[model samples]
Target: MEIVVAADASEKGLGAAIMHRFPNGRDKAITHASRAHTSAEKKYSQIEKEALSLIFAVKKFHRMIHGRKFTLLTDHQPLSIFGCKKGVPVHSANRLQRWAIILFTYDLPMQYRSSTNFGCADALSRLIANRQPPTEDAVIASVDAEVRRLFIDALRSLPLTAEKI
Candidate 1:
């Protein structure tokens, strides 16, 4: 399997996308958006939130693929270091180290992309970041439900053989 992943981050929050190629030539996609980091904006500390968010997105992809080879794309360049030995520079808090460890468990190829080109992932991230719990609850709920339905459909459609049983 070949996969393309993308992530976007801003003052509001983080968003990620994963596109995969199956044996049948069809593609699979997964996206996630979550709250931004609100902690102090110290030198390296600012990346802590982004790193954690990236880890979350990667893990979500792993759950979907079950150890398939995948490529990761991100608007945040720091994440491209997962393939590096020394690892990327991060805060003294060791956030990068923690993220790198988790990343090693998967077969990931990293790449960088501009936010403008990230499309769906960028939109989802911004939507989640700007969401207002009171007014946007219904809209968010609808989108989440739709995504879940799509995921289930995709899983059910996966090629599985009963003869192996």
Candidate 2:
């Protein structure tokens, strides 16, 4: 029972994707997403964002991983230090110290993986909100489910564009 986790965060939000791998190499995935607090969005340092993403992941899935020693993969190089013989970053914010303590509670071995290699988790963390135009605009999308279905059906009837083809 080996659990591999990757987490990433953006100003708009944070997300983590989890994959559980069995002895035979079979695996399954779980994804977590959440909105960022306005404060974290405006002022969280780079390191905090990285640490927080992992924290969010671990806490969100603690039930599945609490008693086990799991591998934590992250794109931020500094985070890997927490798992090394060295030491956690002491110069950064005190919040980092608190986070490190929380992480230490679990026997987590952190590894630094490039975002490319951690695609699933990386993608989970970088969600952008879909903002509709203001109400005053000419195109207020229909609230009626039937109308929306009809509109989608109409689009499906059109020929595919070159790119789509």
Which lDDT tens digits does candidate 1 get at residues 1-165?
577665655556666777776889654674554554444522334456556656767766667645776666666675667755566566545667877888777777776767666676666556663434545788899999999999989977878756655
- Tell me the TM-score of model 1: 0.60
Superposed on all Cα atoms, model 1 deviates from the true structure by an RMSD in Å of 13.0
**Which whole-number lDDT from 0 to 100 does residue 63 have in model 2?**
89
Candidate number of the best lDDT: 2
For each candidate, the alpha-carbon lDDT, in order, equals 0.65, 0.74
**What's the TM-score of every candidate structure?**
0.60, 0.68
Model 2 over residues 13-123: C-alpha lDDT tens digits? Answer: 677877887888755675555545355354888778888888888898898789888888888897876666456666767888888878888887887878777666667
Model 1 lDDT, residue 136, Cα = 79
